[model samples]
Target: MNLTSAAMIGRINPEALGASTLGLALYNTCLMFGIGLTAAISPLVARERGSGAVATTDAIRRLVHAGFWNNIIVVIPVWCLLWEAAPVLRLLGQESRLADEAASYLHVMQWSLLPALIYLVLRSLLAALERPRWAVVTGVGAVVLNFVLNWLLIDGHAGLPALGLLGSGLATFLSNLFMAGALSVAVAVDPRFRKLRLFQGLGRVPWRACATLWRLGAPIGIGIVLEVGMFTAATALVGHYDPVSLPAHAIALQVASFTFMVPLGIAQAATVRVAGAAKRAASARAGWVALMLGLGVALASAVVLVTVPEPIIGLFIDPSEPGAQAVTRAAALLLGIAGIFQLADAAQVVLGGMLRGLQDTRMPMLIAMFSYWGVGLPLAFVLVINNATTGVWIGLTAGLFTVALLLLGRWWVFSSGGRRPPIA
Candidate 1:
């Protein structure tokens, strides 16, 4: 839905698209911290569920409780970050007008963060319980509703106020609110969930369990922040180039993000299934299966991106529009870069998910930091001097490739019975 909105905004004005893109990049960077906490829930629940102990039901309930509180607590700081978006963007050297516009979008979008986190926690709950149909239903419904809301509010249809980018932000907030409410109702009314008593106790905070969740989740959160922060930094760097650079970067990123969603789903499933597997059965085999699945999807997507870059890029901007050729060309080139890195991207994410299944996060977080900031950012800074926006994409590709290799090596050792941390 965000990509769709960005496309629409890009057609209306490239600057709006750029501003919205920067806003969303920043939003996701901050949002991932809270999401990281919730991301732990699925594996934790899967491990408990794998025990096949009726007693583990109690552990599941406690984990769900912890997830809720963790999301709530983390969102507070995220909100503060959103509130200060303008100042932060300024410090990052974004154009003043673009920074102000992005900040306006963030101000409205921030209201959705808490609700979105709540929805994510519930989605994690459902994933752990192996009941994903409800999540699918709610997600589809939210996306459809967002489409209508953005159309009506962004351009002022049927006496509605035309809120431009802010309308898109409002649509996000409303759709998220709807998802949280609908999912809550679905969980509350479903007999399957009721049988497990997932929400039985709400009053107790269970500080110990929460602390354990934080201990396990902090690295996941930090890893996500570091990884996405690299892209955010790339967006900032790209913004300093010609006007077309930011919009083109945003368009290519949207396409890459869509491709990523496929592997991300596989990765999530890999985490749950692998985590649920008994220690005796948890080996490189499971990770390899997941990696192959993700790589297959990535390969297919890369073919589409490479063969039809113009049509794909055409989706976000009119080729016939004056001055749009440059943006389209730039985006197409970035998509080609995205295509080259798809395999590396798929391998790294799936491996990370497999490691999460093994209750490992801290080391992966360090690996990400080393690959992204220590390696990617510096490379991008140097290359951007001559390559502009393309430099950032190349740097990111290198980082992902590095992480993929390192993570594969780590998993190889773990599967070989080398020294490894105990599963959380």
Candidate 2:
């Protein structure tokens, strides 16, 4: 799902104009909810240490084992989603050929779900255990694999069939597999990780851990829904005006995805650092780590995007056609707004991470709902339907700000209150 939108935004023809884009948007909506499931895993694993019910290491080990299997459990829904992709594409008004193409793309991509989920478990366990550098290596490797295969498969290079959209899907599946296999191998070989036998068996911890995971994750997942949904909805709303506007919005979205990695990475790191600090009763350090990296990187990323919006956008847009001109204008509008959003995006994610560190997800979800649905969506509608692309930017920027403010308040309240102090 992560790669799905990127592929669509990067490669699909906007001029072709079909329901595929809208279908993809709906798929993304569901995928966003699935990601929320991880929020449940991290805090549950982290809290085991603070509660004195389980030693930190043991709790983390159990989480790794349980999480690996929990991923397997989610595969059922992944399969169903893939099976439904074609029908959904048809209903969205996609052309026959495009729907066929998308169905194949979705089918191959679904196989990645289990592996991606496995990698997610590894990431959460590693982060909650304060070993996030594990993520840096594995994640980079997976991304590289995705890109290389995208070129090969999409272009039909290296004796591989040129599957186009389906090829991109294949690339994504392979990338997830690479990450899961590499991480598993690394863990198996490392004496520290080996002792935990993270992959050995869940034995009896599955139900308890799954319950705990849902409890922590449901809210975080809802929060992601609101966040990702806001961007997706903006594009959809803009699409009402004309074909080019929405695709241009998608281009800007792709660009933002690349830049957003920083805060998202920092946020994950913050979640781990803060969770660890909270488990150790180190409130000051937790708050500092969560905000400091988030602040520095957010500013840096936003500035880069703002300063060279054209060049950054050029990478994703073909510069030689009339289509290019339309996209360039729309991309510029979206990027300009995105530059402003970087601040709030950074603040909100880091703020949420800080809350994750403190084992609070419920409030953040509420904040996201109010900010995106209550505020951003309505504002976007008024402006977008009125053909105010610039106003769409204003609405999204405001949403990000609202999220940041509310999330920051929650972080301070939870961390300062010390609701999750370590076992004394």
The lDDT leader among the candidates is 1
Residue-wise lDDT of candidate 1 within 20-96, one digit each (tens)?
99999899998888888888988888887777755466777787788888888888888888889998999988989
Best by TM-score: 1
- Score residue 235 of candidate 2 by CA lDDT: 56
| Runs off by more than 4 Å, candidate 2 | 1-24, 47-58, 86-104, 202-205, 278-281, 414-424
Give the per-residue lDDT digits (tens) of candidate 2, residues 183-301.
88887788767877766555665677676676777678778978787876765555555555655676666666677777877777666666555344475566667687878887888
Give the TM-score comparing model 1 with the true structure, all chains together: 0.96
Worst lDDT 10-window in candidate 2: 15-24
TM-score, each model? 0.96, 0.87
Instruction: Tell me the lDDT of model 2 at 33.
Output: 58
Q: lDDT per model, in order?
A: 0.86, 0.69
